[model samples]
Target: MTINVIGIGLDGVVGLNESVRQIVERATVLVGSDRHLRYFPNHSAEIIVLEDILETIVEIRQHLDTPNSCIVVLTSGDPLFFGLGRLLVTHFPPEKLRFYPHLSSVQLAFSRLKIPWQDAKIISVHGRSMDELIQALQQGVEKIAVLTDHTHTPKAIASLLLALDLPIDYHFWVCENIGSEDERVQQWSIDEAKQEIFAPLNVVVLLRQSRIATNQSLDLANLPWLGIPDSYFCTYDDRPGLMTKREIRVLILAELGLQPGQIIWDIGAGSGSVSVEIARLFSDSTVYAIEKTAAGTSLIEENCRRFQTNNVVSIHGNAPDILHHLRPPHRIFIGGSSGKLRNILGVCGMRMLPGGIIVLAFTSLENLHTALSWVEERKKSDRSWNYRLLQVQLSRSIPIANLTRFTPLNPVNIMIISR
Candidate 1:
């Protein structure tokens, strides 16, 4: 027996093709919301108004137990577009299910706007955190489409975006009653949209603003530091910037090389840059930022708050002395230890599993040699051990010859010793 989930579009029955209609007609029992259920102008399938999903599952199972049982679930506008298709697919194996999909509401929204959606960032804030949606927006993606909910309605989004100091030039297109007789599409600026009322059912599209956050301060309020001139990153006098430049940060964090449910230890965490960035990128992983110096500890905490990361634990204790007490971590990052290179590496080296990684952030050749010698000694054992240095040089943009050009920035040497 096959279970089919057909995608319904905003155009209602008119949008559905002939094949999907046949699945509905032959379905032993049909399941959908009343509005969706009414689409079958003529059908012999026993209409089952959906209420509790478990009840529907039980009803389907009962039908399946008898003989030939075919269940067809109908949804509006691409069942996979924040729809019930996922739930059904999870409950039934793929071999037993077939899906007929219509263009997703997001596709329709972008189509109606005559915009290419391939590059657009689509988010469903229906039952999600407003912060996530706002973060994605702050990253300055080219286009954004939001599937809104009653509590997270268009008005609510408009109001929140306005509070975020959304640019005045960016266009907000509120699509309502789409593919319906009473359909109304309203366009407004962020300020105007805050007051523009619309029905509960709506999709919101945010077009790229003519200008970026040129005037916004570099703070949590305005994130991803997008469009901010290269002058925004906080650089220490005569020293490299606290965090890896944005570009390097993205790459190395990619290489911290975490596995699912893995534990990571970041020693000598200065400003918690690596730790905070990793936490933000991999929200599910646990990151420990170890720092001892009063200034270093303060910097780490400040960065954690600055990056808006809730995943890192900033430990104010010193290393080696602190390494002994930690539950063996799967990954370790030693940020150029002040002393006890052998002792700390021995302890961390032993703590890690067979293939676990141990990264060392070192600057000076003396420190790098010391780290290499220690790892080399350990490599003599049954375990495999190796070390590397990340000679990172970063540059940022500045006005030169009346045009913004990247200048050679700071350089740092990061070493990775792993087995």
Candidate 2:
């Protein structure tokens, strides 16, 4: 007894062609939600409401022994995609189930907006947590499509995004009742989306705004002398939210132990968050902000200008290769190494001034291990060489309904080295 799982759209029965209509008409047992069953009111088939999925599956199994059962399970869009079809497939044999798919809400939403979805990261907050969406945003995915529910509405999503205060901005589109008569696809700023109400059946699409669009006027006087917000700096559009957090930056600054008229090197500067802060605090110090990527170097200059840190020299080239050309550093902060950790560390050790301090931050275990290994090798020759590792974890408060909860930033291992 084969189960025919037919995918329907908002248009319902009228949208079905002759072939699929015939399959539905011959059903001896029909299964679907109340809203879906209402579409075929006059059909002569034993009804099964899809309220409790487990109970419905049990009922369907009972009919398998009966003589020639034509079972038609109706669902919306592509049933296999975050739908009941996946559950059905798990219980039934592969040969017993057949899927007939229609355009998904995401598909319809993207079509309405006239954007390609091949590269879009699709996350369903429907009957699930918002963790996936949050992670995707943190990773700086260029495009995202969110399937929403009563709890995780478009408004709620916008609020969460705003609370994050990310380095990059997004163009938020609330696509409501996608294929229905009153369908609406409107773009709103993150602030505007938080205030507006959207239909229950909606998809939220986010496109990472261009670099130019993300630039906002800064009030330097109002900004803090230390702990500047991550959003203040101009970050990479393709890789937003990549800057060192304010808390981590403070920790790194303390680890460096800066002095007047000193030379500081910020290798893999990445927006020069730390470099700008150092330049601001010790105006007499010349901070060389070294970055490999052209985009990163440009951002360093922009952020330096915004913070009015004239002492931060944005050097656009790879580390170790470019480190030799610059003056030896009294202090160094290696935020990134671009997989050349050993080579960079060797050059820094050779060129570092006496009593110089080097602070390296690592988010991955592999990099942390590599740094430790390098230190161990160097310590074999010089017993005076020393290192201290600090595992730093920080979280910020975000509002969930009226209450607040903490979302942790990425854990960082800070290796402070000195001789």
Most lDDT-accurate candidate:
2
Give lDDT for model 1: 0.68
lDDT of 2 by residue, 317-353 (tens): 9988999999999999999999999999999999999
> Model 1 segments beyond 4 Å from truth?
166-169, 212-419
What digit string (tens of lDDT, one per residue) describes model 1 on residues 53-121?
878877766665556767888877777768887777777777877788888877777778888889888
Clashes of each: 2, 0
Give stretches of model 2 more than 4 Å off: 212-214, 339-343, 364-386, 399-404
CA lDDT, every model vs. true structure: 0.68, 0.90
What TM-scores do the predictions have?
0.51, 0.91
List the pairs of residues colliding in candidate 2: none
Worst 10 residues of 2 by lDDT: 209-218
Please list all clashing residue pairs in model 1, or write none if there are none.
8-77, 390-414
